[model samples]
Target: MWISRLSRFLDSVKQTLFILGTGLVIFLALRNSIVWHMQEFWGASGDFWQRRWEELYLLFNQDDFLLSVFGTYIFTTAVFWLCNLFFILLDLTGKPEFLLKYKIQADKNTPLRPADFMKAAKVALYNQTVVGLPMSVMIFCVMKWRGCSCSPADMPTFPWSVVEVTIFTLVEEIGFYYTHRMFHHPRIYRFIHKKHHEWTAPIGLVAIYAHPVEHALSNLLPVALGPILLGSHLATAWMFWALALFSTTVAHCGYHLPLLPSPEAHDYHHLKFNQNFGVLGVLDRLHGTDAQFRASLAYQRHFLLMSSMPVTQQVPEPPKKKSVSE
Candidate 1:
């Protein structure tokens, strides 16, 4: 049994490695050209916008306090709303036929009521302003004490920025995996983590609809620890935070659009509650928490969708086992 599990685990790791390699290749090939074009565009921008941009950048760098208090709040709020509103609209529209094909939990997630949206929005708002703002201040203090650089001149180059974010992702995966699994302990689940699991078929807005303690430990700390440990540039830290928020929202979006990361694994986590407790699948595989997921029909359906065609839940049959003689 252990041997079979190890084989499956190895196959998943190979797939993850292949995806990582392909992403790095593409990022390396395009980043220089992209940066060059961006610089050219900035250079060509008229004096009016250029001055405004400079002023904004200066203001952002003027003090870590302002950035921590206002910048984090504003940036996270904007990204959260932008990402979730799009999906909220889709859900409000009964998930039009065009998108219905990709809805992972279509059967389970019936149309949400107005009150449901209100409850989610209200809790999300409280978390963002009431809970998040103070936490941001604390994180800023920690980062500053740890000697993280906020200087624009000291910002990492694009490749190094990528490297930093990658490390941040790995750190977050480890932190989140263990903290999340711990939350599932019966002694603690109801008091803290249960609120997050309220949306069994999660929507985008519900991504951060967690208990404040759970939000702080599982959602915020994991993402922040990497930059703090590395003493990364403030800019790099913010970039990673944005990506983390967006990706977490996408993971809970319930729709598996083509060209995006598959939501199947997380959607399954929401459904079953006991499997897939990590941001990335790395820790889950090592801990064997994903055993049931790997054996389930959803595992067969878990795929990188490349076509606009509608997806179905049809699980293909396993191949016949060969006899020793054959």
Candidate 2:
């Protein structure tokens, strides 16, 4: 389940890194319109993004309009791919020694298989294309509704506002925690939030696979909530979105890496529902939703200890049909 340091630079590594390198290039190249989308794409629809909702198509017709529009698409698509690449690499090179060094879960679940991966890939891509584009447009509209501009010249400069980023992430996490837990109500879980629970053992790609309503209510709105509430700069808003996406994906990544967000609790939620509902697990523990899960973790430790103890005597199993030679 591990690879040597020497194999790190082998052909497989070279090819994987090449693809990621190309993706990073595309991600950086489309930077301008990526920021512009939040500022200009639907800047004119400040009304509809709030109370109107019908004027969502409002546009500026400014110079280089076409380029900005195309760039927005390219930028967002690239962002999704880049995020996808990060965890996909973990799952893809699942046996790499580097990954084994950080894996937290003592027991390995089912081996990562191609069929299951393809299914997750299909769902993840569907959510990005379906939910991601519309969400970007909505972010612009809401910014406009709140009287914020998308013009980079007027926006915050290079190197985003970290202070604002932390504040925004905190606000989003709080909102997401409450709303996500609410969605688990027995009356609504079956119809509204059940799609996300389909995968008991989640991978990186499984993070984005949710019903559109869940994506909008729990995922998009909460993330955009902080920026809209604070009226933060466009650049700050974009950075917050990136962070939000990263945290969400990491939570679904089955492995529990030391420095990472500790996704095992979330992993447990997928396997055994009705637990670990909070984004940061704060609410889950405070309200005792994770009490059952924490107890189970302790139990797993005990089981491992019992299994590892030396046996004084061996018990033989019933013999199967004898071999032809025997």
Q: Once superposed on the true structure, which residue ranges of model 1 sit more than 4 Å away at CA?
A: 1-16, 25-54, 313-326
Candidate 1 lDDT by residue in tens digits, 82-120: 989888888777756578767887785556677888888
Clashing residue pairs in candidate 1, if any? Answer: none
Candidate 2, 120: how far from true, in Å? Answer: 1.5
Q: After superposition, how far is residue 1 of candidate 1 from its true place, in Å?
A: 8.1
For residues 1-326, write the lDDT of model 2, one tens digit per residue.
13433343364345445533564566569877665774464464443333221122133333223222334446555666677685566665666545544333424433557777787778767766677667767776676677654454445433245556656756775788788888889999998789889877777677778887887788777878887877765546656667766777777776555455556677778878888787655455445566688677522321111332211112122358989998
- The candidate maximizing lDDT is 1
Q: Candidate 2: worst 10 consecutive residues by lDDT?
A: 304-313
Give model 2's TM-score versus the native structure: 0.64
Global CA lDDT computed for model 2 = 0.61
Residue 311 local lDDT, model 2: 16
Model 2 alpha-carbon miss at residue 191, Å: 2.0
